[model samples]
Target chain A: MAPLLEARSLCKAFGAVTAADNISVAVAEREVVGIIGANGAGKTTFVNMVTGYLKPDTGSISYQGRDITRLGPRATARTGICRSFQIPQTFARFTVLDNMLVALNVARKRDLFFWRPAHDAELDAVAQGLLAGLGISGHRDQIAGTLPQGVRKILDIAMAMVSAPKVILLDEPTSGISTDEKHAAMDTVMNALGERGVTILFVEHDMEIVERYAGRVIAFYDGRILADGAPAQVLSDADVRRYVVGGELHRRQPRKGVA
Target chain B: MSVLTDRNVLVLLAAIPLLIAAGPIMPDWVRFFLQVSLASGLAVLGVVVQMRAGLVSFGQGLYYCLGAYAAGMTGHFVGVTDVFALLGLGIVVAAGVAVVLGFLMSRYREIFFAMLSLALSMILYGLLVKAEVLGSTDGFNLPKATFLGLAPTEQALRFAVYALTCAVTLLAAIFLYRYLKSPMGRIGEAIAQNEIRVEYLGSSARTVVHITYVLAAALSGAGGALAALANGHVDPEMANWTTSGQFVFVALLSGTGNVAAPLIGNFLLEMIRVYAVAWSPYTWQLILGATMLLVILFLPGGLWSLVERRKAGG
Candidate 1:
C-alpha cells in the first residue's frame, strides 16, 4: 500500500546546526507512530518541515500522493495535515470556548468576508461538542491564558481536530505536563483523535507512553534516524539504546530481580 | 436583525433623533462643535476598526483627506452639490486607494505598519500643499451641498448638514457594530491575537487585514466628505500627520471598547478642547496633551473603560 505520508531525503540547516540531515520517513494509514529523540535530535524540525512551517532545503514531502513540499502552513493545513505546537497557540485573552469557536469559524474555507455572524448556534454547538469530547468542557468559559498547561495542551489538540485532519502531528503532546497528569492529558488527546484511519505521529521523550500507545517507533539521533521498527524492536536497538533511550530504559530494567 | 437589538447598536440608533432635536436649541458654535465632533468621530471610527485587528494606521487621514477631496473637488470642479453623491464618491475613492495600498500595508505589522501608513499620508500632504490647482496649503472652499435638489434656507442648511452628520455617523456605527460581531470581524480580532493560529486554522491573515483596511478607508472617506460639507472647505491639513494623529488620539481616548465609544470620545475631546481654549487659549494644546497622558496612565482602555468597568461591576 502507498504510504499515507512520505518525506524523502529531507535536509534543513540553520547555520552550523544541522536540524534534519538526509532524513526520510514514511507513515502508514491508521498507524500511531511515536518519534523518539534526544534534545536537538531534529524531531520537531521534522514535524516543522512536514507541516510546511519551514521549507526543507532538499527533497520532497508527499501526502496521499500529492506533493506539498512548498505549501506554506495555511495551505498545508487545508490539505488535511494539521499539527499542534509544543507550546500551545491560542487567543490568550479569549475564553476557551471562544478560542474553539474562532477555530471552527476559520475552518470554513475562504469565508473571510462572509457577512454572517462567525459564531452562530451551529458553530457554537460544534465547538462545545469538541470541547466536551476532549473532556475540557468545564473550562469553556475560563480564559485560555489562565488555564493549566495540561488543559491548554488538550485545547490545542482540540483546535487541531476541528479541521477533521487526515494526518496529525503532535509535538510533545505531554511535555511540560506533570508526570501524574501527562497520562490523563495524553488519554484525552489520543481518545479524541482515535477516529478510524487517521494517521498519528507524536514526538515524545517518554518511552513508556510510546510503548503503550504507538504501534511503531522511529528513534532519531543527531539529525538522523537511528532505528525504525516495532516499538519493542527499535526501543532495544543497540545504537538507539546507546544514543537515545539509554538512561531512560535503565529506570525500568529489572534492577533487583537480575539475581 | 439581532444586531439591531445590541446595546451599542441601540445607542447608535438613539443618537440620531436626540441630536437632530437638540440641534435647534443649541447655540451656533455648540451646533458646529457637535457637527465637527460627529464628522471627525467617523474618521476616528476607522482607526478603531483597524485597531480591532491590532493594527494602528498612523496615516488614516489619507482616506479622510481623499474622501474630503472627493467631495470638495466634486463640487469644486464637477459642480455636483448633492451630499449623497459626494459621500458615495468619497467611499469609492477611499476604498479604491485602500485596495491598492492594502496590498503593501497588510504585508506589515506593529510599528512598520504604523510608520508606513504615516508616511503615505505625509506623501499626500506634501503633494496637496504643492498642487496650485487645489489651492496649495491654503486649500479651497466647498460649494454648499443640496439635499435631493431641495435647497434649504441658511439656518436650515446649517441644521441639515448637522442633521446629516448625525445620521451618517449613526449608520457607520451600526454597520461597524454588526461587522465587529461577524466571523470576518472575529477573524480580524483573532489575527491580532495570534496570526499563526489564524493561518493554521485555514484563513489568511493578509486577506483579513486587507479587507479591514479597505473597509476602514471607506469609513474614513465618508467621514471626510461630511467634514468637508460641514466646514465648507477642504485643506491639505486634513491629510497632515497631525490630523491623522488626532484620529489615533480619539481612537485611544475611546479605547476601542465598542463602535459607539469613538463618538463619545471624540465629542468629549471636542468639549474639553473648547473649554481649555476658553480658559487658557495659549495653553490649550498643553492641556490636551496632558489629558491624553493622564488617560493613558489611569485608563489603559481609554475613556470607554470607565463604562465597561461600571457594566462589569468593578
Candidate 2:
C-alpha cells in the first residue's frame, strides 16, 4: 500500500538559516512516528512545510498519491491532513463543544444556509463523541481557555480529530503539562488515533514518553534527520547520542535495566 | 415562528406599531425622536458587525455617506423620488464601493487596516465636499420620498416613514442575528482568534473578512439612505471620520452579544444629547465624551455583557 504521507528531500530556509534541509520521510498507514529534536532543530518547521503552512524551497510532498507541495494549508487539511499546535490554538472565549463544532464545520461539505434542527443535533452528537473519546466530555461546556493545560491539549487534539484526518501532526502534544498528566494525555491521544486507524507524526522532547508510544523514531538536528529506526536503535545510535540524546539517555540506560 | 418567539427581537418588532400610534397621540418632537432612533439603530448594527469580528472600522461613514449621497443624487439628477428605487440605488452604490475597497482593506491587518480605511473614507469625504454637482460643502437637499405614487403631506405620513424605517431596521437586525449564528459567522470568529489556523483548516481568512466588510458596508449604506430620507438632506459630514467614530462608540457601548444593545445605545445617546443640549447647547460633546469614557472604563465588554452578567446573577 502507498504511504499515507510522503516527503522527498524537503528543504526550507529562513534567510541564512536552513530550517528543513534534505529531509525525506514516509508515514505508513496506522503508524505512530515520533520526531525528537532539540530547540531550533527544525522539527516544527518541517511539520509546517508538510502541512502547507510554509512552502518548501525544494522537494515535494504527496499525500496518498496526490502532489500537494504547492497547496495552501486549508487545501492540505481538506485532503485529510490536520495538525495541532505546540500551544493549543483554540477559540478562547468559545466553549469546548463549540470549538469542536467549528472544526466539524470545516470538515463538512454541506451548504451552511440550511438551518435544520436535525443537522445541528447530528453535529452535536459527533462533537460530543470526539470529546468523550479524548476524556474531555466533562468539560464540554467549559470555556476552552479556562481549562487546565492538559485538558486544553486534549481539546486541541479532539478538534483535529473532528475531520477524521488520515495523518495527524502533533507539535509537542505534551508540552507544558504536568508529569503525571502528560502520560494520561499521550495515552488518550494515541488511543483515539489508534481506534480511528489514523497515522500520527508527532514532535516530542520527552524521551520516555517518546519511547513508550513511538513505533518508529527519527532524530533531527540542525534541520536534518540524524537517525531513524526502532525506538531502541534510533535512541541508542551514536550520532543521536551525541547530538539529541546527549547525557540524558546515558542516565536512563540503568533505568531501562530496572524496567 | 422562530422569529416571533425570540424575546429580544420581539420588543423591537412591537416598538414599530407603538411608535406609529404615538405619532397621532403625542407631540411632533416624539415622532422626530422615533425617526432619529430608528436611523441610529441601523447605523449601530453596522458597527456591531465589525466589532464582533474584532475590527475597529473608521470607514463605515464612507458607505453611510455614499448611500445618502446616492439617494440624493438619484433624486436630484435622475428625478427618481420613489423610496424603494432610491434605497436600491444607495445599496448598489455602497456595495460597489465596498467591494473595491474591501479588496485592498482585507489584505491589511489590525491597525494598518483601520488607518487605511480611515484614509480612504477621508479622501471620499474631501471629493464630495469639493464636487460642484453634488452641491459641494453646501450639501444636497433630497426630495420628499413618495410611497408608490401616494404623497401624504400630513404628520401621519412622517410617522408612516418612521415606522417603515423601524420595520426595515428590525428585519436587518434579525437577519444579522441569524447570520452571525451560522457557520460563516463562526469562521469570522475563528479568523479573529487565529487567522493562520483558520487558513490551515481549509478556509481563507481574507475571504471571510472581505465578505464581512462588504456586508457591513452595505448595511451602513442602508442606514444612511434612511437617514437622508427622514431628514430630506445629505451632507459631506455624513461620511466624516467623527461620524464613523460615533458609530464605533455606540457599538462598543452596546457590545456584540445582543442585537438590541446597539439600538438601545443609539436611543440612549440621542436622548442624552437631546436633553444635554436643552440644558446647555454647547456642552453636549462634553457630556457625550464623558459618558463614553465611563462606559469604556466600567463596562469594557459593552452594555450587553452587563445585562448578561446581571441576568446570570439573578
lDDT of 1 by residue, A1-259 (tens): 9999999999999999999899999998888999999999999999999998999999899999999999999999999999998999988888998888888877876247446677678788889999998889999999999999989988998888898999999999998899998888787778777853568999999999999899999999899999999999999899999999999999887898677
RMSD of each: 1.7, 2.4
- Residue-wise lDDT of candidate 1 within B280-306, one digit each (tens)? 999999998899899999999999999
Using Cα atoms with residue i matched to residue i, what is each candidate's TM-score against the true structure? 0.97, 0.95
lDDT of 2 by residue, A173-255 (tens): 99999988899889988998999999999999999999999999999999999998899999989889899977777776665
Q: What is the Cα root-mean-square deviation between model 1 and the actual structure? A: 1.7
Listed per prediction, chain B TM-scores read 0.97, 0.94
Using Cα atoms, each model's DockQ against the true complex is 0.68, 0.48
Candidate 1, position B238, lDDT: 94
Worst 10 residues of 2 chain A by lDDT: A110-119
List residue ranges in candidate 1 displaced over 4 A.
Answer: A257-259
